[model samples]
Target chain A: MTNLTSLTIRQALDGLKKKDFTATELTEAHIKASEAARHLNCYITETFDHARKQAKESDARYASGRAGLLDGVPIAMKDLYCTEGIQTTAASKILEGFKPPYESTVSGNMFRDGAVMLGKANLDEFAMGSSNTTSAYGNVINPWRSEAEPDKQLVPGGSSGGSAAAVAARIAMGATGTDTGGSIRQPAAFCGITGIKPTYGRCSRFGIIAFASSLDQAGPFARTVEDCALLLQSMAGYDPKDSTSVDRPVPEYFKAVGQSVKGLKVGVPKEYRVEGANPEILALWDKGVAMMKDAGAEIVDVSLPHTKYALQTYYVIAPAECSSNLARYDGVRFGLRENTDNGNLNDMYEATRNAGFGKEVKRRILIGTYVLSAGYYDAYYNKARRVRKLIWQDFINAYQKCDVLLTPTAPTPAFAIGENTADPVTMYLNDIFTIPASMAGMPGMSLPVGLSADGLPLGLQLLGKPFEEETVFKAAGALEKAANFTALPQSLMDKAA
Target chain B: MSIDINTVRKVAKLARIRTTDADAEVLSGELNNILSMIEQLNEVKTDGVEPMTSVIEMNLPARADEVTDGDMPDKILSCAPEKAAGFFVVPKVVE
Candidate 1:
C-alpha cells in the first residue's frame, strides 16, 4: 500500500469508510512519521499514547456507524491552546510545565468531531516573532530546503511555524494555528501548505493563551484548500465563553471549495507592489493574476493608501495588548516562579518574569509597557489605535471596488533560521504582506501556487471581506486548480522512502 | 524620542521583568530601532479618528453578571507554581 500519511484528509476519510484501513492503522502511520521527523522540532509535546486510545475509540465508532467528521484523523494542536491534563507551553519558559484544566473551545470542537491529537505544536514564545526563533523550546525547521543547499535550515514562518511544518511534512493531516500578525498564513506560505485566518471572532478565543486580544484569531493548516475547509468546519463556531465570538451559524466550508470563481472581482492593490521584493515572488504574483483572469475573475487595480504604515502600527498595538495580556504571569498562579522567598512582592514578580520569559518575549513586554506607560500612552498607543482605524478603512474602501484581494503571502520565501536575526525590526518585516489583512480583521488564506528559482515554495494570499470566507474559498479553489502545485518537500519524499 | 539605557531600565521595571545594567545597555539600542520604525506613524494624519476599541462593529455585549462559573479552586490552581490551601502563595507585602 502507498504511505498512509501521503493521503489527503478527504482521501483518508473515504478510505476509512470503505474499510481500506482501520483508523488505528492510520493513526499509527502518522505517529511513525512524526517520530522520524522529530529533528524538525515541530511539537513541544508528542501525545502518542493519547492518540492510540483516541484512534481505538474511533474504530469502535466506525464499526457502530457513528463516526464523526474527523473520525480518526491525527492532527497537531498548536501549543497555545489549553488542553486539559496536557502540558501546553506557548513555546515560552514562562508557560513551561503548565497544564490547563480545561480545553480551548476550538480544540475541544476538533476532539468532539473525533480528531485525534498528535501533540502540542511549538510556536514563537507567546506568539511574538515572525520567525519561530523566539520559541524558547527551539527553532522550528521548514521541511522545504533550497535545492542548492540541502544542509541549510530555513525557518517555518511563525509564530504558527510548527503547525505549518507538521502539515507540510505529512506528519499531521491538518493542524490548528492562531494568527495575531500573519502567524498562520505566512508560515503556511513558507512551508508549502494551505492555511487560513478566518475573520475576527470566527473561532472562539476561550482558553487559548492571549497575545493581542482584538487581532488574534484561530484557523487551520492543511495540505489542500478543501482539507483546510474540512478542518475549519470542525474548529470554528460561536461560543458564549468568548465574548468576542459572533453568534452566527457555522457554514459547511467544504461546500465553498471547488466552486467556480467566474464573474468574481479580484483586486490587486497597487500599494502591495512595494520596492525591493523578491523578483521571483513578483513574477509569481503576475502569474496568479493571469491565472485568475483566465478563470473569469475580473482583475482590477485598487489602492490601500495606509498599507505603508501597517507594520509600524502593528508593532505598537500588538505589543501594547501583549503587555496587558501577559501581566497574568506574575509567579502567583501559574507556570514558573522564581525568587519567591524574597521579602518583597514586586521583587518576586521582577525576578520570576525576568527568569521565566525568553529574550524576545521580554523585549516585546518592555516595548508594550513603555508604549502604555504614563507619559507615552497618547503618543504611541493611542496614535497606533487611530492609525489602525485608517488601515481598516483602507480595506473597507478597497472592497467597494473588488470582491477579493490578491497579494503575495510573504516578501520572500523562507530564509535560513539564523539569517534575519540581526535586528528585531528585520524579523518583523517578514510578515509585511500578510499583516495588513490581519490588522483589518479580514479573513485571509495562503496557498502554494508555484516554486521559486531556488526550488522552494512560494504562495499567493487570498483575502475576503469580514465574515465572507465562502468567497475566499471559491477563489482559492479556482486558483488551486490553475496552479496545480505538485511539488513536495524533498525531506518528506525521502522520509516516505 | 529614542530610548536610552535608563529608559529601558525604567520600563523593564514597570513591566516587572528585571533588567540588569548590561541587558539595559543592549536593549536600549534595539528598542530605539523599533521606536524609530514606529515613528513612521507620526506622519499619518489621524486628526479626528477615534482609538480602535473594536475591530468589528458590535457593542460590548455584557452577559448577565451572575455566577457563570466558579467553585473549582483545585482546577484553577492545577498549574500554579506554588499554591497552598486553595490560594496561590505570594511574597509577603505587609511589613
Candidate 2:
C-alpha cells in the first residue's frame, strides 16, 4: 500500500520472497501508476493483461519456492524488442501491427528469469533520433522538469527515451534498452536513471530490431547501478541464433556491483572537454573525478584524438547499416503496405515506406543509400570505415594508460522537446560524448552524478575495455556510493498519481 | 560533397522508394546539409589503415549446412500483407 512501485527491483524481489507483498499487488501498483502517468507517453502499448498474468504466474512460483532471478519484478521493454504475441512497433508506423511470431533472444532470456512485462516502452521511430520526438507514437515527456519552469515539458533523451522515463517515473523497476549510438546512455542521463550498453555481442541481438548491426547492443536501464548489474546478469549470454554473440561465459556481473575500485586507474579523457560544452556539465565531470579519487581510485588524464570524428563516423556507418537492415520491410512480407489502388509492386514499396517512416528515418535511409551508391562508396562509406578504425585505435591507445575512462554523458542536461529537432546537425551533436565507445564496441554506462543549474539531473559516463563490463560496474559502483545520488522525480510521480 | 536534386532522385530510385519532384528537392537540401557534416571525415588521414568491417576482428563462425530450422510456413507467413498458397502474394510480374 505504501507505493510498492517506488521500490527498486532488488527490494521488490526481497519483498516478494518475504511474503510482505504479493507480485500481483506490486504489478497492480505499477499498472495504476502507469495509467495515471499517461501524459508522459512512455509506453506505446500498456500490457495490463499480460503483466497481470505474468505476475500471477510469478506468485505461483513464489508459493512453490521456485522463484527465478527476476520473479514477479515488473519492468518495461523498449518497443524495438519483438515480443511473440505482443505488438512490437519500434516506435515506427512501419512496424505498427507487427506481431513477431518469436521472441527476441534477450527478452526470452528475461522471461525465463521470471521478469514481468509492464509494457513496451516508446522510442525513436526505428530508434533513429536523439530525441523521442521522432516516435510515431508521440514524444515521451521527461519526468524531470526544471524547477523554475515546472510547466515547460522536457524531453527524455532518446531512442531509449521511454525506458528511461518509465524507470525515472517509478512506473517500472527497470527497463530494457538498446544502444546503436548513445540511445541508452543519453536517455538514461536525461531521465536520471542508470543505463549500460554492454560490449557489442555481450547480449544477443537476435530479436531486437537492428539499427546499426555493428553498434547496436542491448542493455538495461535501472534506478541504480546494482539494479542494472542484476538486470544485465540475466540479459547477457551466448546464443547461436545471433552469430555475433560471443561464446565467452557470462560473468556474475551483480557480484562485481559493490567491488572496490581502490587501486584502479581511472582515465579522464581530454578530448571529451569539447568546445561549447556546458560549464556545469564540466564541473560535474570534475566532481565525478573527485568522487572516484576520494574512493581510492587514481584519476589520470588521457587523450583520444579521434574522439571529435566519432559523430561523423557514426552518422555514416549507422545510416549505411540501417539502410540495409530496414530493407526487409517491403510490403509483401510484413508490416504496413500502402494500398495504392491497382499500383505496381515498386509503387507499393515506395508508398508504404514513405508513409510508414518519419522524417529522421527517411533522412537516414537516403543518406545511407547515397553513401553506399556507386562512385560515392569510397569517398564516404569507406572513408568513414577507416575513421571508425582510427576511433577504435584511439580508445585502444588510451586504455593502455588507465583501466577505465570517464566523461560527461552529454553536452548538457535534457533540453526541451523540439529545441533541436529542426536542425539534424545540432541533434547529432547530442551523441558526441557517447559515440566513440560504441564505435570501439566497449561497455559504457551513464549514472546520475549531480544536478544542473536548472536543478535537472546530470550524468557521468564510464567507458571500459571490450567485454569488460565488470570493471565498469565496479568503478561506477564506487562513484555511485561517493556521489550518493538520491534525487528522484517523486513530485512528478505524485502529480501524475 | 553537396548533393543536388538530380542525385536525390537517382538515389531514391535506386532505393526503390517513390518521391516527387518537390520531395526530392527538399531531400536534396537536407542531404547536402547532412553531407556537409559527414564531409568532416575527410579531415582524418588514414593512408594505411584497414577499413574496419566490424568491431571484433573475427571471422564469422561457420555452421554445418544442416536443416536446423523449418516446418512453420504458416507461422512465418502469418504477418504477410498478402499471401497465396504457401507463398507471399505480390503484384503480378507478367501480364
Candidate 3:
C-alpha cells in the first residue's frame, strides 16, 4: 500500500484514476490523519459527512469517466472564505456566528472542479497578525517538532497558519490560502511548505472576505511546487462578480513547472540585507543563490530601495481599506448583535460593535479612521499612498534586469506565541520581507530552503512580474528539486505511524 | 503626537467600540507608544509626490449602468437584529 502521509496530490490523483484506491478510501485516510493531528488545532470546523458525500460523488464521476484535475482531492479552505451554509468566522469573535448564504468565488471554483472540502481551517482574525496567536479560536500549534518537547511549541505563522500547518502535517492534500502582506508565504516558510500568492486580480475576490482589497490575493499551499501549480490552475480565472477581477485569460500554471531554469536571471535585492535579520536566514538565502548559480542560473544584484517604505505604506493602506470593509458588521447587518437600550440608533450601533469586534480589529479600525479623517488625511493616508507609488515603481525597475527576485521569506523563523503580541510594532515588522511584492501587486512564492540552527524551517521567496506566475513556479520548482529538504518533523511521522 | 485618555475615548466612540474610563487610560498610553513608533515615517521627505491608489494604472472595465441585482430584502432582513416589513429597523432619528 502507498504511504498516504507521503503522497502528493498528483500521486493521489493518479492512484485514484488507476483504481489503486477509491476516493472514499483516500478521504477516510485523510480524515484519519486529520484526527490524529487534532492536537495541532489545524482545523476550525470539519465537515466529515460533507467530505464523504463529495468523495462518493467524485467516485461516481470517475465511474462515468468525467473527472477533473482536482477530483476527489481533499483540501481545506481558510476561514476567511465564504462557504454557503457553513460558518465562516475569519477566526474572530465579531463574526462568531456569521454564516454566508452564498459561497465565495474561489471555494465555488474548487468545489465545481471536484475537490473534496475537508473543512474550514483557522487563521488570524481578519488575517491581521503575523503569528496565529491572535486568533480568537486559540493558537494553532506547529506539528513539525518532536512530541518529547510538547511544551516547546513553535508558531505555525499567520494569518494562514492553519492552512499551512494542516497541509504540512499531511492532514489534507492541499489547502487554499490568501496572502495580504505575506499571510501565505510567511506561514508556508514557517511550516516548510510551498505557497504561492498570485499576481493581484488573477483570482477573483468575489467571495473571499476582504482585508486590504488592493493587496489580497488567493493562492494554494501544498507540499510541492507542482502541486501548488495544479491548485492555482483550478483556482484562478476572471469572474464578473468581483469588480477588481482581471479580465485576462488564465495561463497554464502546470505547463512550465518542469521547465529548466538554466540561464534565468535571479535578482537579490541589496535592501533586504538589513540589520536584525537572523544570520541563519541570511546564510540559507546565500546558499539558495549559490545552488541556483550551480544549476546554471545567473545571480544579479538588483536594487529595490523603496523596500524600506513598504511596511509604512502597507500599514496605512491596509487599515484604511479594512476600516471600510469591516464596517458591514454593525451588529444589525450580519453578526453578533449586542442587547440595546430601547431603539437608540447610535447607542445600538455602539453596543453591537463594541460587543462584536475584538481588540485588534478595533485598533485597526481606529487607526484607519484616524488616518482618513480630514485633519490627518494629508499627513498620514495620502503620504503613505504617495510612497506606495514609488514602491511599485521600484519593482518595475528591478524586474528589468531579472526574471525573478530572491529573498529570505521572513526576518527570522517563528517566534514564541506571546513574544511579539504585546508590541504591535515589532509584530508588524515581521512582514518586512513579504510586503514589498504585495504592495506592488506582483506574484510571489516561498519555497523551503533548509532548517535553522534551532531546527525550525527557513524559507526562500521568489518574486515574479505581474501575471507571470509561471516564471515563479519554474524557478521555485527548480530550487525545490535541487534542495530536496524532505525532513518532516518527527511529531507528524510518529502520529501517522 | 502623544495620545491621551480624552483622545482614546474620542477614538473609541468614533470606532463604535465601548471603552471604560480605566480602559481609556490604559489605551491612551498604548496608542501613544504605537504612534511614537509610527512617527518614524515623518523622517522621510516626500514633497511633491503624487498619491498612489493602486500599483497598476490600467483602466478597469466599466459595467453598464444597468440593474444587475434584484432586491434581497428577505435575505438582508435575516441578518438584522431588529426588522420591520421589507426593511431593517433602527431607532427613529428625524422624529
Candidate 4:
C-alpha cells in the first residue's frame, strides 16, 4: 500500500469503503507518522491509546457497513479545544495539566461523527503570537524550508501553527484551528495547506478556550480544500450552549468543494496591495486573479478603504476581550495556583496570573487593561470600537460590488524562526493581510497559489460575505485546481519514509 | 502616547497580575512600542459611528425562565486547583 498516511480524507474514506485497509491500519499509520515527526513538536499530547480504541470501533462499524460521515478518519485537534479527560493546555503553562471533563461542541461533533483523535496539536500560548514561538511546550517548526537556506528552520505561522504543521507534514489527516485575528488562515498559508475561518458563530465556541470572544472562531486545517470542507461539515452547527452560535442550518460544505466558479464575481481589493509586501507574493496574487478569470470569474477591482486600520483595531479589541475572558484564571479555579502562604486574595490572584502566563500573554493582558482603563477607555477602546464599525462597513460596501475578495494571505512566505519574535509589533504585523476579514466577521480561506523563487509556498486569501462559506469554497476550489501546488517538505517526507 | 513604568505598574495592578519594578520597566518599553503601533487607529475619523459590540447585530435573545443546565458540580470542580467539601478553596478575603 502506497503510504496510507499521505491520502486525503476522501481517499481514505474510499479505501475504507472498498475494504482495501481497515480503519485500525490507517490510524496506526498516522500514529507512526506522528511518532516519527515528534521533532517538529506539533502535538502537545498524543492520544494514541484513545485513537486505537476509536479505530477499533470504527473497523467494526465498517464491517457492518454502517460508517458515519467521517468514520475511520484519524485527525488532530488544536489544543484549544477541550477534550474530556485530556489535557488541553492551549499551549500555556497557565493551563498546564488542566483537563476538561467535557468536550468542546466542535470536537464533540467530530467525535460523534466517528473521527478518531490522533492527538492535541500545539499552538501559541493562549493563541496570542503570530509565530509558534510563544508555545510554552515548544515552537512548532514548519516542515517547509526555503531553497536559499534549507538548514534554517521556519515558523509554521500561528497561533494554529501546530495544526498547520501537522497537516502539512501528513502526520494527521486534518486538524481543527481557531481564528481570532487570523490564527487559522495565516498558519495554513505559511504551511502550504488549505484552511478556513468560518464567519464568527459558524462553529460553536462553547468549549474552545476563549482568546477574544467576539472574534474567536473554530475552523479546520487540511492538505486539500475538499478535506477542509469535509472537516468543517462536521465541526459547524448550532449549539444552545454557545449563545453566539447562529441558528442557521449547517450547509453541505463538501458539496460546494468542486463547484464551478463560472460567472462568479471575484473582488480584488485595491487597499490590500500594501507597500512592504514581497513582489513574489504580489505576483502570486495576480496569478490567482488570472486563474479565477480563466475559470470565468469576473475580476472586479473594489476598494476597502478601512483596511489599513485593521491591525490596530484588532490589537486593541482582541486584547480588551482577552483581558476580560482570561480573568477567570484565578488561583482558586482550574489550572495552576501559586503563593499559598499569602492568605490575601488579591496577592493570590496576582501571584497565580504572573507565575502562570508567559511574557507575550502578560504583555497582551497589560495592554488590554491599559486600553480599557478608566482614563483611557474613550481614547483607546471606544475609539477602536467605533473604527471597527467603519472597517466592517468597508467590507459590507465592497461585497456589494462583487461576490468575494481576493488578496495575498501574508506579506511574505514563512520567515525563519526567531526572525520577528524579538519585536512584538513586528510579530503582530505577520497577520496584516488576513486580520481584516476576521475583524469584519466574514468567512475567509487560504489555499496554495504558487511557490516562491526560493521554493516556499505562497497563498492567496478569498473572503466571502457572512454565512456564505460555500462561495468562498467554490472559488478556492477553482483556484486550487488551477494552481495545483505539489510541493512537500523533503525532510518530513524522508522522516515519514 | 508613551507608557511609563508607573503606568505599566498601575495597569498590571488593575489586571491583577504581579509585576516587579524591573518587570514594569521592561513592560513599559514594550507596551509603548505596541501602543504607538496601534495609535494609528486614532487617525481614522469615525465620526457618528456607533461602537459595534457584536458582529451579528442581534439583541441577546431571551429564553424562558427554566433550568436549562446545572447539577453537575463534581465535573466542574474536578478541574479546581484546590477543592474541599465540593467547593473551590481560595484565599480568605474577609479580615
Candidate 5:
C-alpha cells in the first residue's frame, strides 16, 4: 500500500469508511511522517499520545455508526488557538509556558467533529511577521526550496507558516491557520498547499490569541480544495461567545467544491499587477486566468483602485487594533510575569513585556501605540480606518462586475530565511497580494497552480464577496482541476532523514 | 513625520514595554521606517468616509446583559501567576 500520509482528508475518510485502513493506522502513519519531518520545525508541541487517544475514540465512534464530519482526520492546530490543559503559545516567549483553562471555539468545533490534533503548529510570534522568522521557537522551514539553493533554509511564509508546511510535508491531512494580512494564503502558496481565510466573522474568534481583532479570522490549510472545504465546514459556525462571529447559516461547503463555474464571472484586477513583481509570477497568473477562462469562467477586467493603499491602511489599522487587543498581556492575569520580586505594577509590566516579547512584536506594539496615541489618532488611525472603508468599497464595486477575483497569491515565491528580515517593510510586502482581500472581509483562497522559475510552487488566489466562500471554493476547484498540480516536495523527507 | 528616539521611548512607555536607550535608538529607526511607509495613506483623500468599526455588516449583537456563567474561581485563578483566596494578586495599588 502507498503512504497513508499522502492521502487527502477526503480519501482518508473514505478509506476509513471502507475499512481499507483503520483510524489508528492512519494516525500512526502521520505520526511516523511527522517524526520524519521534525527538521521543518512545524510544531511547537506534538500531541502524539493525545492524538492516539483521539484516534481510538474516533474508531469507537466508527464502530458505533456515529462518525462526525471530519472523523479520524489527523490535523495540525495553529498554536494561537487555546486548548484546555495544553500549552497554547503563539510562538512567543511571553506565552512560553501558559496553558489555557478553556478551549478555543474553533478547535473545540473541529475536535467535536472528530478531528484528531497532531500538535500545535508554530507561527510568527503573536502572528506578527510575514516570513515566520519572528517565531521564538524558530522559523518553520519551507518544505520546498529554490532549485538553485536547496541547502539554504527557506521560510515558510507566515504567520501561519507551520500549518502550511505541515500540510505540504504530508505530516497532517489538513491544518488550521489564522489570516490577518495573508497569514494563511501566503504561507499556503509558499508551502504548495491550499489555504483559505474565510470572510471576517465566518469563524468565531473566542479564545484564539488576538493579533489584530478586526483583521484576524481563522481558516484551514489542506493539500486539496476539497479537503479545505471539509475542514472549514467543521471549523466555521456562529458562536455566541464571539460578538463579531456572523450569525449566518453554515453552508455545507463540500457540496460547493465541485460546483459548476460555467459562465461564472472571474475578475482580473489591474492594480494587483504591482510593478517590479517577478515576470514568472505574472506569467503563471496569466496561466491561471487562461485556465479559468478555458473552464468556461467569464474573465472580466475589473478595477480595485484602492488596492495600492491597502498595505499602508492595514499597517495602521492592524497595529492599532493589535495594540489595544494585546494590552491584556501585562504581567498579570495569565502568561509570563517578570520582576515579581517586589517590583511595582508599572515596572513589572514594562519589564515583563520588554523581556517577553520578540523584536517584531515590540515594534508592532510601539507602532500601534504611536498611531493610536493622542494627537496622532486622527492623523494615522482614523485616516487608515477611512481608507480601510475605501478598500472595502473597492471590493464592493469590483464584485458588482464579477463573482470572484483572481490573482497571484504572492508577488514572488518563498525566499531564504534571512533574505527580507533586515527591513520590516520588505517583509510586509509579501502580503500585498493577499492583504487587500483580508481588509475587505472577503473570503479568499490560494491553490497551487504552477511552479516558479526557481522550481518552487506558485499559487493563484480567488477572492469572493463576504460570506461567499462557496463561490471561492467553486472557482478554486475549477482552477485546481485545470492546473492538475500533483508535484510533491520530494527532497523534504530526504533532508529530514 | 518620522519618530525619533525620544518618541520611541515615549511610545514604549505608553505601551508599558520597557526599552533600554540602545534598543530605543534601534527601534526609532525601525519605527520611523514603518511609520514613513504608513504615511502613504495620506495620499488618499478620505474627506467624508467614515472610519470603519467592524467589517461584518451587523448590528452589535444584543443579548440580555446578565451574567451567563461564573463561580469557578479555581479555574479562573489557575492561569493567574499570583493568586490567593479566590483573588488575583496584583501589586499594591493603594500603597
Candidate 6:
C-alpha cells in the first residue's frame, strides 16, 4: 500500500485492469490519504461520494471490458475549474458559494475519459500570487517539510500551490493546474513534484475562471513525469466552444516519454543567470546539464536577451487582460454580490467589488485599469506588447539552435511564506525563469533535480517550441529517470503513515 | 511617473474597489515606486515597433454565427446573489 501511493497513473490503471486492485480499493486508499494529509490544507473541498460513485462506475466498465486508459485514476481539480454543481471559488472571497451551470471543458473531458475527481484543490486567490498565502481561505502549507522544522515553513509556491501540495502529499495521484506566468511550474518546483503547462490553447479554457486569458493555460501536476504526460494526454484537445482553442489534433503524449534524448539540442540561456539567482540554483543547472550530457543530449549556449523584460511585460499584459476578464464578476453577474441602494448603479458596482475582492486582487485590478486607461494605454500596455514580441522572437531564435531550452525553475527554492509577500515587486521576481516561455506561448515543464543546501527541493525547467510538448516531456522524463529525486519530506511521509 | 493620492484613489474607484484615505496615500507611494521600476522600459529603443497582443502570432479562429451554449438560466442564476424571473437582478439605473 505504501508503494502503491507512489505508483504512477498508468501503473495504477494497469493494476486495476489486471484486477490486482479494485477501483473502489484504490479510491479508498487515495481518499484516506487525502483525509490524513488534511493538515497540509491542500484541499478546499472533498468529493468522497462523487469519487466513490465514479470509481464504482469505472469498476463496472472494467467488468464490461470498456475501461479507458485512465479508467480508475483519481485526480484533483484546481478550485478554479467549474465542476457543474460543485462550488468553484477560485480561492477568492468574491466567488464564495458560487457554482457553475456548466462544467469546464477540461474537467468534463477528464470525467469523460474515466478519471475520478477527488476534489477541488486550493489555490492563490484568482491565481494571482506566487505563494499560496494569497488564498482567502488561508495559506496552504508545504507538505514537503515537518512541523518541527519551523523555519522551513516555506510556501508550496503560488496559485497552483494546493494542486502541487496535494500531489506531493499523495492526496491524489495527479491534479489539474493552470499556469499564467509560473503558477504551475513554480509551485511544482516548490513542492518537489512534476508539473507541465502545455502550449497555449492545447486545453480549452471555456469554463476555467479567467485570470489572464492570453497567458492562462491548464495542465497537469503529478509525482512523476510519466504521470504528468498521461494526464496531459486526456486533457489536451480542441473545443469549438473556446474560439482561441487550437484545432490541432491531440497526440499520444506518453509515447514520447522514456524516448532517447540522443542528439537532442538543449539550449542554456545566458540571460537566466541573473544577479540575484542563488548560487546553489546555478549549480543545479550545471548538474542538470551533466545529467543530460550523460544521457547523450548536447548542451548549447543560447541567448534569450529579452528575457530580462519578461516579468515587466507579463505584469502589464496579464493585469491588463485580467482587468478586462474579471469585469464579468461584477456583483450583478453570477458570483458574490453585496446589496446596495436600489437607485445608484455605480454604488452597487463599487460596494459589491469592494466588499467581495481581496486586497491583492484589488491592487491588481487597479494596476490593470491604470495601464489600460486611455492616455497610459500607449505608454504601458502597448509598449509592453511591443516588448512581448521581442521576447517571443528571442525564443524563436534560441529554438533554431536547440530543440529545448533549460534553466532553473526559480531563482531559489521555496522561501518563507511571508518573506516576500509584503513587497509585491520582490514576489514578482520569482517568476523570472518561467515567465519567458509563457510569454511566447511555448510549452514548459519543471522536474525536481536535487535539494538546496537548506535541504529544500530544487527544480530544472525545460521549454519547447509551440505544440512540441513531446520534446519537453522526453527531456523531462530523461532527467527525472536519471536524477531519481525521491526526497519526500519526512513530514508528508509521517502524515501518510 | 509619480502617481499622487488623488490619482490612486481615482484608479481604485475605476477598478470598483473601495479605498480609505490612508490606503490611497500608501498606494500613491507604492504605485509611484512600481511606475518608476517600469520606467526602465523607456531606456530601450523600440522605434517603429508594432505592439504585440498575444504571444502566439497565429490568427484566432472565428466562431460561426451559431448559438451553441445551453440555456440553463436557473442553473446560472443559482449562484447569483439576486435573481428574478431567470435574469440577474441589479439596481435600476436609467430614467
**Model 4 superposed RMSD (Cα):** 1.2
DockQ of each: 0.86, 0.82, 0.61, 0.84, 0.86, 0.69
Q: Is candidate 1 or candidate 3 better by lDDT?
A: 1
In model 3, the runs with Cα more than 4 Å from the true position are A146-150, B91-95
Instruction: Decide which is better by TM-score, 1 or 6.
Output: 1
User: Which CAPRI category fits model 4?
Assistant: high
lDDT (10s digit) by residue, model 4, range A1-497: 86998899999999999999999999999999899889999999999999999999999999998899899999999999999999999998889999899899999999888999999999999999888999999989999998899899999999999999999999899999999988999999999999999999899999999999999999999999999999999999999888899989998888898898999999998899988778998899989999999999998999999989999999899999999999998978799898658688899989999999999999999999999989899999999999889989999999898999999998989999989867799889889898888888999999988888988888989999999999999998999999988888767656558
Candidate of highest lDDT: 1
Encode model 4's per-residue lDDT on B1-95: one tens digit a residue.
78999988889999999999999988988999999988988788988999988889776767899997899999999999889999988888777
> Which segments of model 6 are wrong by more than 4 Å?
A1-3, A146-152, A341-343, A495-497
- Any idea what lDDT model 6 has? 0.87
Q: Mind giving the per-residue lDDT tens digits that candidate 1 earns over B1-95?
A: 98998899889988999889999999999999999999999999999999987787887778886997899988888788778988888878787
Instruction: Residues A269-366, candidate 2: write the lDDT tens digits.
Output: 99998888789999999999999998999989899999989999999999999999989889888898887877688888889888888888888998
- Candidate 5 displacement at residue A25 in angstroms: 0.9
Model 1 pairs whose backbones collide:
none
TM-score of each: 0.99, 0.98, 0.97, 0.98, 0.98, 0.97
Please report, as a residue range, the 10-residue window in candidate 5 chain A with the lowest summed lDDT. Answer: A488-497
- Greater lDDT among 1 and 2 belongs to 1
- Candidate 4 ranges beyond 4 A from true positions: A493-497
Compose the digit string of candidate 6's lDDT tens values, residues A1-497. 43567788888988888898888888999898888878788888888899999999999999999988688899889999999888889998888888787899999989988999999999999999899888888889887653445556778998899899988887799999999999999999999999999999899999999999999999999989988988998998999888778888888888899999999999999999898678999999999999999999999999998888888888888889988888887887777777765657777788778888887787778889999998999999988888888888899999999999999999888888688866678888889999999998999999999997767889999999999999999999899988999888767656458
For model 2 chain B, the run of ten residues with the poorest summed lDDT = B10-19
Fnat (0 to 1) per candidate: 0.93, 0.76, 0.54, 0.89, 0.91, 0.65
Estimate the TM-score for candidate 3.
0.97
Q: What does candidate 4 score on TM?
A: 0.98
